[model samples]
Target: MFLGIDVGGTKMQFAVGVGEDVFVLNKVPTPSRYAELLQVVEEHCSEAEKRFEYAGKIVEMGIGIPGTFTKERVVWVPNIPCLEGQDLAGDLRTRLGAGVYLGNDAQLALAGEVWKGAGRENSNAILMSIGTGIGGAIMIGDRIVKGRRGAAGALGWLNLDASVPGDKNHGYLENYASGTGIAGVGETHVPPLSTYEIVAKAKEGDSFCRKTMDRAGHLIGAGLASVASVLDTEIIILSGGLSEAIETFKKPMLDSFIEYAAPGVEQVPIVKSELGNLSGAYGAVRLAMVRGDMWIG
Candidate 1:
């Protein structure tokens, strides 16, 4: 059995599988402290090791974090501050007594896609995830594009509006297109709503909610256009929580893409994730199996 963990800002998804498909999956709320986070993960790993079908048999493990990191040490994780500067991969390897790999969450999702999802057979692809924040991963010529700082696909930092000054802390794209960003706009109404609630209301034909999603979708599409213009990737896979409501905003997003995209860029296909939210976990497993020594930094 191989273990994969996708660590997000608000939750952690643990998946155990033999190959491309998961056997068991579990989710837990993300703890604020690094120690608590490690404890929770260790507990889950122990449980998986004890499962009857997989008892005393483990091959490798991989963890995906939502920020920049080297092979074993985390450099920065803005959403989860406590994880910054931690050697999570080393710690896990020591505790589990098995080979462990670590990678950026979005990058791992792309790896998963390449292995068995939308990007299968494609050498070039892009992945964009919009949840509490926006992130992306890029693949070119069959290799993950890790910049010198290991921040190659930090898509949220893409600046669409250069005229107005943006948030000092968060990226402009993330400030308007993330789940939290959508909820921020929803909060301005007479009665506030969460991102999911707003999406549900929009599906029910609520005008305000629909407009909110449309605007966010437009912004997201614009960002994607910028990406497509540069890399001309074969496909763009959309995942994460906000993507679940894509039906509500897909039109506006496509419309904006057509409007801003370079000639021929509009033809690029943008699709939903085949693996959905578990793309990262599957990716972790894939990396663990194939690229255990792949130096992300």
Candidate 2:
């Protein structure tokens, strides 16, 4: 049996999968402290074992994180400031007593897509998650192409602005197009509704909400075009809470993407994700099944 754990910026999801069937083991709000996170994972592991027929110590466990895991299982999680360079897998193995694998959350989502979601069609694909921040993962022929230093799909470095040559991000793209970005847009307006609420309002014909999502969509398309021009992937799959408003945002986004895409890269399709929010956990579970797949392993 395998256990999958997805640790997001906001919450943590757990699941147990045997063969083709999976059981949503549990979901819990992620806490900040390292010890608290360990505690939660331990509880979930026990619960999953109880609910499922797997009795022996968790044979393999996979953790989908927001960033890369390097030597000694150190996790370089950026958004979750406190986890930077911590020995995540080693710690988990010690606490849980078995094999533990660590991987990027976005990469796991891509794996989920390829496994049973929208990305099943093509061998080469790009999966981007637009939410509190934007994340990307690249897969070629069923393999995630983690570049030297494991930063190939790190799109935050895609310079949208040439003026600030070294700027990690623009206040707009990082603070407007993302879930955190759109929420930052009206931080002082309408009581600071969440991106989910914003999309809900836009669906109800709220003009301001619609405009906010449209602009964000356009921004996202422009970025995606840049990626397409370079990689020329078969398709780009988008997911996250923001994608819920695809109806109101797709047109402008498509237009902007076409406007920015270079010549001859005409048919790179943009589509919604099929994995929903479980991609991360599913991907994590898949990662644990692979042997000798770790960095510096």
Candidate 3:
């Protein structure tokens, strides 16, 4: 058995799975303190191991954090600034007494989509997760396109409008298009609503909500246009919390893409992410158990 944990900014998902089928799982709110997050992992692992009698039987464990991780196990978590440069894999092996691997959450999520979800049938695809911030990953033949610095397919930070002031602040496309970003715009107006709730209210004829999502879709499409121009991928897979309203924003997003995509770069498919909320956890399993070389095959 293998264990995969997807660590998000607001929550954590633990999965014990063999291949694509998960046998056991758990979810918890994310802890702000870095050490407390580690404790959560230990607790979840202990419980799962006991439930499945997997203490010594589990050979490899993988964890995906919503930040940057290097091959040597160094992590640079931007959101969780306190956890920056922490050697998470080393700590996990010492504490859990097992082999472990660590990787960026976006990479893991793309891997899951490739192995068992939306991109299963395709070799080259891009996953664009619009959440707290726009995140993206590229999977080619089951291998994540992790570049020299392990920041491949990081479309969020791309330079689109060089003339736009503060472009640096919104380099990651999610900064402008993510649900969190949208909510940030209306922070002073209405009670805060999650990405999903905002879209829901829009569908129920909330004018403000509709405007917010449309604006978000426009910004996302612009960023995606840049991705398409560069990668020319098979498809763009949308996941994360805000993706629940994909049906609502698909046309508007596409319209914006049409307005932005250069000539001769048409025909790329944009579809709702097939894996939904489970991709990150499933992706974590792949990252944990499969070596970097193994995923290429």
Candidate 4:
């Protein structure tokens, strides 16, 4: 069996898969401290083994982390501060006594999509997760493009408006396009609400919420356009919790994307993820299987 873990800013998800079947799945709030995070992972692993009747069985493990690493040590983790500069994979392997592999969460999600989701039919694609922050990955042919420092798909940092240089908030695209961005925009009219609540209100005909979502869509589209202009991606897949509200803003997003995209590039298809929120976990499982040489595709 292959074990996959997706460590996000707000939550952590775990899954166990054999072949095409997922036998175990769980989620929990992501702990902020390193110790608590490790404890939670251990507990989850124990629970999975108990529930799946795989007690004491050695399994290949893959972890999807929301950060970048160098030499198997975490170098940058903007969302999870406690993980910075830590040897996460080594520590996990030591504790679990099993093979542990690590990968960028966005890249893993892209991999999952390529393996069984939206990108299964596309040769070149981009996957963007627009949640608390915007995370993205690029895939060319059969491999993910990890640039020199494995920071190739940091799409959140893409600068869309040059005039608003040096904004005191987060990065340009992240500040305006992510779930947090949507909530931030919604706060102008009333108290802050979760991304889901904002979308719900918008669906109920709240004009302010609708406008906020619309603005977010345009910004997201602009970011996608910037990427498409450079890579000429064959397809763009949107994931994360915010993607659940794609119906609200997809049209305006496509419109803005077409407005900014290079000639002929606007024709590229933009779609929602088929794997939904489990893309990262699925990708992590695929990575584990690949590293273990148990599956080839």
lDDT of each: 0.85, 0.76, 0.75, 0.82
Clashing pairs in 1: none
TM-score of candidate 4 relative to the true fold: 0.85
Better of 3 and 4 by TM-score: 4
Instruction: Summing lDDT over every window of 10 consecutive residues in candidate 3, give the lowest-scoring window.
Output: 288-297
The pairs that clash in candidate 2 are 175-181, 176-181
Please give the range of 10 consecutive residues that has the lowest summed lDDT in model 1: 288-297
Number of backbone-clashing residue pairs for each candidate, in the order shown: 0, 2, 8, 0
Q: Where does model 4 exceed 4 Å of error?
A: 32-36, 46-56, 167-169, 190-198, 292-297
Put down candidate 3 lDDT per residue, 103-152, tens digits, no spaces: 77887888888778877788788888876677788876657777666666
Off by over 4 Å in 2: 54-57, 78-82, 148-151, 164-166, 169-172, 187-201, 204-209, 292-297
**Candidate 2 lDDT for residue 57:** 52
lDDT of 4 by residue, 2-57 (tens): 78998988889898877677654878999999989988988877877777774345
Root-mean-square deviation per candidate? 2.6, 3.2, 3.2, 3.5
lDDT by residue (1-297, candidate 2, tens digit) is 788889987789987777776667667888888888888888888877777755545688888887766634644666675577678778888988868877778877887787778888687888877767777788876688765545456654455766744544444355558878778666756677777778888889888888888898788888889988888888888887666668978888898889999886657889899878998888887777663263221
Error of 3 at 241 (Å): 1.7
The TM-score between candidate 1 and the true structure equals 0.88
lDDT-based ranking, best first? 1, 4, 2, 3
Q: Which predicted model would earn the best lDDT? A: 1
